[model samples]
Target: MNPPNSLNPALVALDSLPLVVSLAAPIGVAYSGGADSCALLLAAAERWPGQVRALHVHHGLQPAADDFVRVCESVCTGLTLPLQVLQVDARHGPGDSPEDAARRARYTALAAAARQLRLQAVLLGQHADDQVETLLLALSRGAGLPGLSAMAPRFERDGVTFYRPLLQTPAAALRDWLVRQQIAFVDDPSNSDERYTRNRIRARLLPALDSAFPRFRQTFARSARHAAQAQELLVEVAQEDLDRVGNPPAIQALQGLSAARQANVLRHWLLRAHQATPSTAQLAQLLGQIAACTTRGHQLHLKVGSGHITRAGAVLRYTPLGDKAG
Candidate 1:
């Protein structure tokens, strides 16, 4: 591997990051031993020196998991930075996808590690291409503003602040920089397997998009930013509406608002309060049921994500299906 050097232009390009002016250190880098993450680890170590730590999660889903950790050990040893490795079960649940399961496990592990280390923040290495891929995936899945907004540059999960410092950087730039610097990093074979939607998009859709729109990454990122801004406003409005409507959302008060506002507020209530998301059909049905509830005799019982939305007296209530009471 190339030796550590000055903060050159190449490094600076990888540095347009975090969307936050200041972050509390000692910061942790989520190191997966991939090109994108390796570039981030190197940059963070260079910039922060003693203030940096590497956090690697070993999802024992593949044979190379141990190899990845070994690479992380080598890199962290060379940088004189502490490395924390967390072994995680990334197996998907009955209704969950493998990618989602792995991602959830990875984030949980990262947050736990950061908390244990007393690190103020964790930096992720998802780049511009990954952002574009997320946007495309959302589009393909008919996702709303939340998904269309794609990945947030900064977010809080499990009470830990996470930053995607390389969100605006290009994938090619990271790999190219790694090549130039002779940085050693592993390539996850799953990334090339086209069975996954993201891998398929990366293999097929991205090249086509690039050919058609040379600056698709920047433009797509701009669109995502707009979506995020709009979603933020919607959230503000939803919070106001929810406060007016009550947490359980009184049926009479909900009926006072327009269908669009009702949809907005209800969606916000389910997602924010219950961590539940209803499908479009399910939400629409719930709205129809609400509209039909002109008498006390009318009932509301609809199945939502892993939960059931039911009428508890005059207000709506969501209970996990797992609860015997639900």
Candidate 2:
């Protein structure tokens, strides 16, 4: 496959980097008909041609959702790229917000599409600005090192490697590229809605920060990079501890480490064992309760979805709590 030399200057620089070269498989770009994703699709088509296909997930949240899909199809057709459009039911569960439900459903559909198509990797158009916003949101939630680390360039989930090749590209640069190419795209109005925390950050907090500090985005991106490196080291240390202690002995293994190490180990163990990530608040409360309990026989449980952590003898075990007997 030819390299993407004709892409925007910023993206051209990213494509030359080692990370993109080392990706495990050919890239499948997720196209949403937004400027960011459209630029990525075009760049991928030029760079990887036969290796890139456009995948679109239609959540049907907006009235023009189908039209957006049509635009994506047209773009792909013009570029002679294969296109897959998936319709997902994103209705929220009781007490669950729409955004959360929609995102979960979207990823589920994308993963299914990837598996069925036998695709090894999926590319997203998440850019440097998005990473900065995510890092700030994580900090606002009092997230520890891992959360602050934000998105990685590549991550494996559900047997597919998700690649964010444009992580270092700025949103403005993508917009400029699209304009230069005379590419038409849809602007999702939901992005401007202030009700969502992410929207609020992008609309309010980020602008204020940008006005006061012109390089706020770059600063946050750098901070996230530093946090990612630190988290990597912490994860190595936590893995060593896990190897030494095996499993928590009556949750006592948690109390044995320094507070930072305890959090790291707990996060790592939960991720490895159950593939679950507890909220920052939930993790803090769970750790505190686990440490303070005096009665050896008292069972300490923290429930997430159908999963629960229970203290058994001297070990804390994660188990899927039984469903209601029907």
Candidate 3:
């Protein structure tokens, strides 16, 4: 039999990930000193050798965060790979989710660090369980098609390309491999805190799912892919409609389309052009106002996701939260 960590299940899974980058280009791995990321860092370093670098984001939210950096530094030193540690504030504002704020901060810091280092792409360690959890959370929130589509394997954010290669692999397989190889990894204490919905799902729901469905990971992933395909078609239609309706979307041209198309195109416009998303209530209200505006004297002003969508003459305009008064 082959030695542990040599052509192991976890390593094989990582190898199967269809990455699109030149072999000569450098890559950065988001190392969190956890089992999944540690396994990924080891596999990537083995494959790319000198071309792989570890990028660890220190959110400074907990006292143990400093130990994570020390472990990452030690591992990188042993592998002869460069390690970059970035300090970021992951605090949340009023009515904001702590998880979401930390995620945004981490991504922004990672992108900035990757750009500064001239890395071609960054790799993440999100696995199959995480994907399934995301889908469940979306379902619980009555999310739209985009939310149902879950995480994409490859995505661009802040001009940096990121890839999730382990989405097909299970978390247990990675942990098992790490144990067999006598590798060390720290478990984040927050992961066990049941105060979070995700942790509760991981602890209580996953075991039940494993017992009943057995193949929930593969099946759930298949559904997410189908949703993603449907979302892509919707985006294409929205693009065509926006082209006809105009950038600011002339109210007259927008009213010509069906209510469904109006909603689709408008949602696409706000997200693509203004980086804003409307809540369901906000979109429904905006749609009604657009339908009622037959007279030249009719006015419209509504709040939508950190911005206000108001009628400026014959077209709809988005003014950011700060510029609303102007």
All candidates' lDDT scores?
A: 0.88, 0.78, 0.91
- Model 2 segments beyond 4 Å from truth? 1-10, 17-26, 248-255, 276-310, 323-326
Identify the superior model by TM-score, candidate 2 or candidate 3. Answer: 3
Instruction: Evaluate model 2: give its lDDT.
Output: 0.78
lDDT tens readout by residue for model 3, 1-326: 44674554546766777776577679999999999899889988877778998999999999999999988888888888899999999999999999999999999999999999889999999999999999999999999999999999889999999988888788988888888888888899999999999999999998999999999999999899999999999999999999999999999999999999999999999999999999999999999999999999899999999888888899998999888444
* Per-prediction TM-score: 0.93, 0.84, 0.94
Q: TM-score winner among the candidates?
A: 3
lDDT of 2 by residue, 103-150 (tens): 788778878888887776787888878998899888887887878989
Worst 10 residues of 1 by lDDT: 1-10
Candidates ranked by TM-score: 3, 1, 2
Model 1 clash pairs are none
Tens-place lDDT digits, model 1, residues 221-263: 9999999999999999999999999998999999999999999
Query: How many clashes in each candidate?
Result: 0, 3, 0
Determine the backbone clash count of candidate 3.
0
- The Cα RMSD of model 2 versus the native structure comes to 4.4
Better of 1 and 2 by lDDT: 1
Worst 10 residues of 3 by lDDT: 1-10
